[model samples]
Target chain A: MSLDKSVVNVSFLEVKVWRGKDDGELVSYQVPGRENQTVLDVVSEIQRSHEPSLAYRYACRVGVCGSCAMTVNGMPKWTCRTHVKKVMDDGVLTIEPLRNLPRIKDLVCDLSPFIDTWQQAGAPFCGTKTRHEAPANIDPESKARKAADAGLQCINCAVCYSACDVVSWNKDYIGPAGLNRAWTLVNDARHGERQSTFDKAFGSGGCGSCHSQGNCTRHCPIGLSPSESIAGLKKSALFGLPKV
Target chain B: MERSLFLTQRLTAMALGPLVLVHLGLILFAVKGGLTAEEILLRTQGSVGWALFYGAFVVMASIHGPIGLRNVLREWTDLTTGLINFVTAGFGFLLLFVGIRAVLAVTQTATQISG
Candidate 1:
């Protein structure tokens, strides 16, 4: 693909990028804009031409791998998927790291806390079948399986985690992603520790902590509804324990 | 446990939903002709229906209010969980005592006076 020289040099976008950790200041940069340029493209431009020390993380620039999420103009989003024109305010952009997590540097945040919360919610699936055992037949149209399918597409992007207000307000509260994962596992028939998942989900800082604000649902790039999953967990708790 | 508290709050809220509507509707209906304490007591005094309805209302509210407040305190304040639980439990008991007393004053006292 040949680059259009006229289009490349025609427009410059004013981008304000965060420069440090928690106490960071927004450093301004002039990034050359192109047609259909993404927020990741803007950051890459700043890194290549302007600031060599600009720290950010990205891979598979095509919206997979869930690595390019950042807070673009006060909203947590997949920067690779977010168009510059869509979020720019009057030809200016402000980008920062995802919220509710420890900031490592400029646009990178420590996802360890988010992962820890997932474990706390008992999100890891434990199957009863051994390697020699045949696959358990599950009806795809079953209600439980359907419910599990609703939340299975989560790529652990942490976008929903960053967007959750409950996580922001209560640090101990396991955010939407973890609860969503647990919901999927709770409905899985093959899961060996469904009861344990239920225990952790209904434990302190679990599904009960969710405010049902739907920020996770709204801000998810994949359109997954973690709020619904948490609601399912609450409803399941009311009925009885999960089937082991 | 958090699960039990969550269930209690939700169940009480469900009970309160219709109770609140009926209470508000009664208020609106009763005040149409301008109600007084004597007139209110005249209708409610010695009434089993009124006693049961208000008794259930008081019980549900006592359970619901503290759980909701516990959630608020947990989110908004930095208080320890144990302290919050203690305070909210005390609040629940206080609400129960006052609510039951009011129910008795409205129903039992009226029944005694009329009898």
Candidate 2:
């Protein structure tokens, strides 16, 4: 789409993009405002036209890939999906790396910690059925299946992880994303290591650490409620375990 | 330990919810409804019902208060889990001892009233 000269001549967005590693300065970029512009478009323009050295991550240029999440005006958002007009505050936008993770570079935080927490939560599914066994037919309408289905679509974007205050306060907290993934696995009847997964979830850095502040649910791009999932985990942990 | 603490915190909170409402409602009634200390104690003194009600409240609060404080201390301070747990357990015991003593004093007032 062509930019309107009238709109470009009138005003430009005062974009403050974070530059360099953690503790780096915010570099300002002046990009002409256009109708129906996305935050990603501004970043791309800054990289393509102005600052080639500016580093950020994105793929598919849509919401599906989950690679383009960043802190937009103090809120963690999927930058590719965030419309510039909608999020503009006082005609300015402050873009930075996701919170609660170590910043790697400009608009890029290292996701290793977030990914490791997922594994720590024991989220990966291990089926009990052997190769010789026929496929276990799961009724989608079943209560357990439905409960699992609510949290199954997580893309591991770490938005919930970034949004979690508990994670921010406690580095060891398994976080919403990890707990949400674990909640899915817990509801799966075919999961081989259910007891172990429960053990991991109830460990020191597990779901017990979450304060149920609901920031993870509020900022989730895909509308998944990790808060609810974590609550479920807490309940399951309470019911599954023998009386203390 | 973490999981058990989490469970106990939640359980205590559930117990505290109704207890708190009753406590607050009693306070409001006492303050606004113009009931004097004697009038209030007349019903409460030697009453097993009041003893049980406040006993449960005290029990739940002792557990809940320390756990909540332990979390806040963990987040805001540099204290380790072991140290915090040790300190908070002492605090819970202190609350329990004092609270039970106060409850016993009020309940034992029946002898004084009769004498």
Candidate 3:
């Protein structure tokens, strides 16, 4: 976590970083190698000593915040949790912004498109009950509740979004994360807009667009299976919605 | 609607799975038995079972093929949804017409056969 340049290093790691917006090239820098260093640590070191203008994002420096997600060596991952030794190839590291979103700068992408798709899929939960009423008793062990719980822990990191090929090919298709969010809401007993949510999920560029390639599931840092969530949505369409 | 199309595609696919296996098995049986074209025609001729089986196959295939084509065209091309639907519907009708004619030609009795 320390960027202090006074500490001498016995070995150096060649790190290639994307330097600009969409038209940028990978600029190389020799970073001091350290044991137990994360990819975020390397990027921070490069910014501290080599290029002051290099732009990227990170917070909490731990796995909790999903902001540090980027394409490392051709795979979408949470750079904060990814160690340098595990991802580097031939003593080299390549870092770039997450794909399927507009690049704002070097490694910072505009997350508006990702957020907008979530809204389009009716991901925002609509509450049917107010504070005055007692909370709805949902059995956690129920099939619908279990299905909902399976996808409820999404961090909205867009790692799955970046890994998805459907998003790259079909501009209108709401990607896996959004569909996953919709699925959780669909299974909820208290959501007032279940029908609308179903309509939105099955509409144009909805769950039907997913090819079930499992890229979203495979690349997810939180281990959530958006592919499974999407399949559940399709299954709901086949057999009517599960009775909550 | 997309939901209807999705459901239809899946249901037809389920139907097609067994139909295709039976069709392929029939092909192998005929080839192994060294049955000539005339011999195959004679067996199929005037048989309502063969007629109904092939009729169902053609109908399911006609419905199934274009729906899949619609999905592929929507994903891989710049065509409008309306245009894609139109094209796929036309393809389905074409398949039905040609498939029905072939089924009739094979299954019709000798007395019913015409030029």
Tell me how far the alpha carbon of residue A230 in candidate 1 is from the true structure, in angstroms, after superposition: 1.1
- Write out the backbone clash pairs for model 1: none
Runs with alpha carbons beyond 4 Å of true place in candidate 3: A1-9
Poorly placed runs, candidate 1 (over 4 Å): A1-9, A241-244, B109-115
Ranking by TM-score: 3, 1, 2
lDDT of 2 by residue, A56-155 (tens): 9999887888898999999999988889989999999999999999988898889999999989999889987899999889888887788788998887
Instruction: Give the local distance difference test score of model 2.
Output: 0.86
- For candidate 3, the TM-score of chain A alone versus the native chain A is 0.95
- Itemize residue pairs with steric clashes in candidate 2: none
Per-prediction DockQ, in order?
0.82, 0.56, 0.80
Per prediction, fnat is 0.88, 0.71, 0.71
TM-score computed on alpha carbons, candidate 1: 0.95
User: What C-alpha RMSD separates each model from the true structure?
Assistant: 2.0, 3.7, 2.0
Q: Give per-candidate clash totals.
A: 0, 0, 0
lDDT of 1 at B11: 89
> Which candidate achieves the best lDDT against the true structure?
3
Model 2 off-target regions past 4 Å? A1-11, A241-244, B25-44, B109-115
